[model samples]
Every structure is written in C-alpha cells, then in structure tokens.
Target chain A: MTKRVAIIASNGGLFDAYKVFNIATAAAATDQEVDIFFTFEGLNLIHKEANKQLPMPEGKEHFADGFAKANVPSISELAAIAQEMGVKFIGCQMTMDVMGLEKEDFVDGIEVGGAVTFLEFAKDADVTLTF
Target chain B: MENLKANVILDAKGLACPMPIVKTKKAMNSLEAGQVLEVQATDKGSKADMKAWAESTGHHYLGTIEEGEVLKHYLRKSSKDEASEKKHPNVINNEELEKKMEANENIVIIDVREAAEYAFNHIPNALSIPLGELKERINELNKQVETFVVCRTGNRSDLAAQKLAAHGFANVINVVPGMSGWIGKTTGINK
Candidate 1:
C-alpha cells in the first residue's frame, strides 16, 4: 500500500528546522506522498530570509558553528532537497497575515493556505506527524 | 567511521526520518544480499529510523558511529529475499500468542526482524534469525518445533513463514500485524 505522510512544522528553531527538513525529505525519499504545513512559529521555516539563518535557541554560536563543522546541510539546503524529492511545502495564511509577511517573504514554490487546506490533506494521511 | 566499507554509501546528511530510511531502502534494493551499505546522516531522528528500518527490512543494523553532528550507520545485507505475493498460512494475533505464553506453550518464536530490532525491543525469548538470514539459517530451527515468525509490520515475517514452508517446515505460523501491534509483555537490550 502507498503510504501518505503529513507533517505539521510548528517550530522553527535550529533543531526544529533540521527536524522538519530531515523528516520531509526522508518521507519523500520513500516515494510516499508527503506534505508539510507551516504554522505559528513554524512560519519562519518558509520565510526565505529567516530560513537562511536558523537562530540558535541556546545563546551560543557553537550550535551554528557546530553544524558547519559537521557538514550538516543548512535548512535552506535541506528544504531544497525536500522539494526536489516532491514533498509539498505550504505556508499558513493566517500566520502570514499575523506576522505581516507577504508571499514573496517565503521560499519560492511555497503554496499559501490555511488550516482547512492542511486538514484536507491530513484527513487522508496514513501518517500525520508534527515537528 | 573511517574504515567502514559498503557496496553503497548513502549520504543522508541533514535528512530526517522517512527520508533517511527511504534513501537507505532504495540503496539496499540495488544491492544483493550480504552487501553492506553505509549511511551518513545529520538528523537525530535518523538514528532510530535507520535502526528500526534496517530491522524491519531484514538488513543488519551493524550500529551507528557519530562524528560530531554526523551519524554514520552501517548495514550489511542479510539476504536477497523480497516479500512474496503468495500468502503464508495460519497467521495469529498477539493475543493468541500472549495466551499461549501464559499457558506455558512449547512454541518456538523466531523473530525475522534484524538483530538491531530484536536487540532494541521484542517479545522475550524470541529467536533472532533475520529474514535475510532465514534461508541459510533454517537448519538452526528445529524441524519439529512449532514455529512462530514475526517482524515489525508482519511483511518480512510473512515472507519468512512462506520460505520456511517451502523448505519443508510444516508447523510455521506468522505473527500478524507483528511486534508493532503487540501490546503484551516485551523486552529489549537497548532500553
């Protein structure tokens, strides 16, 4: 049976940024239908400028430096990979409005939507997860 | 990490959950049984996913070596066997087996999951002959033993049960829905 995976990206810290990208890319690799909905703090994940700089939740440069040393792909890079793997990226409209962001603020190909749109995808998803 | 050799080296760095597992599965399919694959990943989730996936698919989850943020996972192919369309007979639920265990039954439980999976978590006392190794290790199982084979989701176990039957074992039964569905008592080495 073909597996459908839906992920809700509601966090956008360094760790969470990596987590959502990793999972979305991985699920896409499985040839499963995969979608990610950006909401609340997760909205930062789709914002082009914000995603480029993943703020360290801990007050330290070591986290970002550590990622560099380990050759970990940046969240933007991982997002690109996830997109290439056919994973759909959706930016939450309500959050976008609340945050005073425009469509251009998000990465290219991010489909703007609200909770109802994501719920439709989630309803049929065999596996619905959150990050 | 430096000395590890593999037929395929999957660079899943920065990739999460299903992606690392997904890429590993694809890499594994390209190889013959017993060939090794090394996966390097950055996402922490890949640690558990790789271990669980390798066991689910019957590949040897040799273990992971971490270098800073990077996780290097090694897997050796167990066998070339794939899940067959043909059904294996007499599938039983976890409840029935739990009852059997409670009743002090003589049934022999063969865990067809990878050694990592068996080690991580499984029914207590289940034998570890991964599905990949099942063809060669069939002799290790007593022919007269009442066999119960299991995997994570029952896919590999189904294949193992059928394989045992083809090899002249008559008392093999596959555990339906596998260990993932089992709610009774369980144990493992990892926890």
Candidate 2:
C-alpha cells in the first residue's frame, strides 16, 4: 500500500527546512508518495541563493554546530535528497505574485502553480503535514 | 576459532545510534531470501534495533552472540513472498574512503555538507553539492563512476548515499566521520 503524503511548506525557516526535508525523504524512502507545496516564506526554500541565507533560529546559536558535527545535510542538500527519493516539489505561484518573484527566481524543475493545484494533491493524500 | 562466514557481514564498531541499524538494513537487502546477515557491532543498542528491524521487515532475527567487546548479530532474510526491505548499502570509513580516493582514478567525491562548511574546509578535489541541493543538482555528476559522498559526519552522506544508490548510481559510498575526521589534504576557500 503506497501512502500519499502532502506537505505545506509555509515557514521557510531553518527549522522548517530541516523538518520539511526529513519528512519528505523519510516518506519517499519508504515508497510513500510525497508532494510538497511551497507557499509564502516557504518559497524562499526553493530559491537558488536566499535559501542558504536562512539563519539558524535565534537562541540556538550552537544548534548549527551540532548539525555540522553530526553531518546533518544542509537544507538545500536535503531538498536534493528528498527529490531523489521521488518527492515532488511545488512552488506556489500566488505567493510569488504577492512577493514579486518570477519562476526563474526559484530552483530548476520545481512546478510553479496555485493552491488549487496543491489542494488537488492534498485531496487524496493519506497524510497532510504543514511546516 | 572457526572463521565465520555469512552472505553479508557488516562490521559496525564504535558507531552511534541509527548508523548500525542503517548499515544493517542496507546489508540485509543485498542478500536473497533466507540468506543470513551477520552484523558485528560495538554499540549496545544495535541488538535491540536488529530484532525490531527484522520484525518490522519480516526477516528472522536469529539473535546475537557477544564476545568480549563485540557483538555478532545474525538475521535471516525474509522469503521472496514477503515485502521488500529498504536498504542503502555501501558505506566507507574515513581511512578506507581516503585510501580509495588516493589509489583510484576518476573517483568523484561529493561533499554534501553546507556551503559554509565546504568553504571553511573540504576534501581536495571534492565537489560541493550540499544535501539540500543534491536532489535538484544530481545531474551534474556522472552516474557511471564511483562517487564517494561525505558530510560533517556520515549521517547526511548516508542519506545522500542512499539517494545516489536509488538514483541509479552503480557505485556509491558514504564516507564515515565525514570531513570532521578526514586525514587527507583539504583545500577550501578559507585556505
């Protein structure tokens, strides 16, 4: 039984990136279908450069050190891992319009669409996660 | 002492949580139905993980034999009728990985660590493809050759290693202790 997973990536912060990739890859590795919808600030995660500038959350200055020491894949690297695991990536078009960003602003191959498209994926999904 | 033989035997000493289990799962997948996989590990928790993993995957957990500091755990692969177990095999320690890179020609080492870490310190001649960018940028590397992946430790690279294997990279190795314990020459932006 292949489970369907739909993720709403709305935060686009360091924490969110970590969570998003882990969940997406974990599900995909297990043969589960995963779709991630990047909306609002979440769209930043799909950007070429802005995603790297995401600051490790405040009050956790040493958290990144722990990740580094533990060899935790960076957020972008996690994106690659997730994709390779067959997780589909979607960037929200409405969010881009509101933020004045073009399709070229995001990473390659990420489908740019509206919430209607995302909802269609979410409709039959067995699990819906928001980060 | 009788020399031990197994369809697949994994040496996992001095490693921490998740790694032993991860490697064991990977090793088991390479075997055919009913083949035995022996895991010699130092971590105490692997004993439990092994049993739990076998149960979950429908494989038979034969049990563990403890000798001195090492524990040898045996597991029998499930029958063909059983569901397939997920695996990400082919792990390499820092020493073995470094030696292979030193000796072998046309071996590509992709560092999946973050850019900041890559800029600060990275293996000489290793390409930077941080984990987050890996899925999108996998096309950059040639899948035909041996690709050694490294991260801060082995955790991220293990994941990346699995991704590469899944993506049809015939020969993929995850370097343990990553760049943190690498003993070879490294040239980064800071250097």
Tell me what fraction of the real C-alpha contacts between chains A and B each candidate also makes: 0.40, 0.00
Q: Write the per-residue lDDT of candidate 1 for residues A9-123, one digit (tens) a residue.
A: 9998878888888777766665578999999999888788898877787877666667666556777878887887788989999988998998898888889999999999999
Q: What lDDT is obtained when candidate 2 is compared to the true structure?
A: 0.76
The CA lDDT of each predicted structure is: 0.78, 0.76
Q: State which candidate has the highest lDDT.
A: 1
Tell me the RMSD of model 1 versus the true structure: 8.1
DockQ metric for all predictions? 0.23, 0.04
Give Cα distance to truth, residue B189, candidate 1, Å. Answer: 19
Instruction: Give the TM-score of chain A, superposed on the true chain A, for all candidates in the order listed.
Output: 0.93, 0.95
List TM-score per model, in order: 0.52, 0.52
lDDT of candidate 1 at residue B32, scale 0 to 100: 78
Put down candidate 1 lDDT per residue, B1-191, tens digits, no spaces: 12344567889886545556767876877987656678898878777877776655556676677788898787877754444353886798888888988887566999987665565568888888877778888778887778888886677888899898888887988888778788987876433
Report the CAPRI category for model 1: incorrect
- Candidate 1, residue B113: CA error in Å? 17
Model 1 residue B54 lDDT? 65
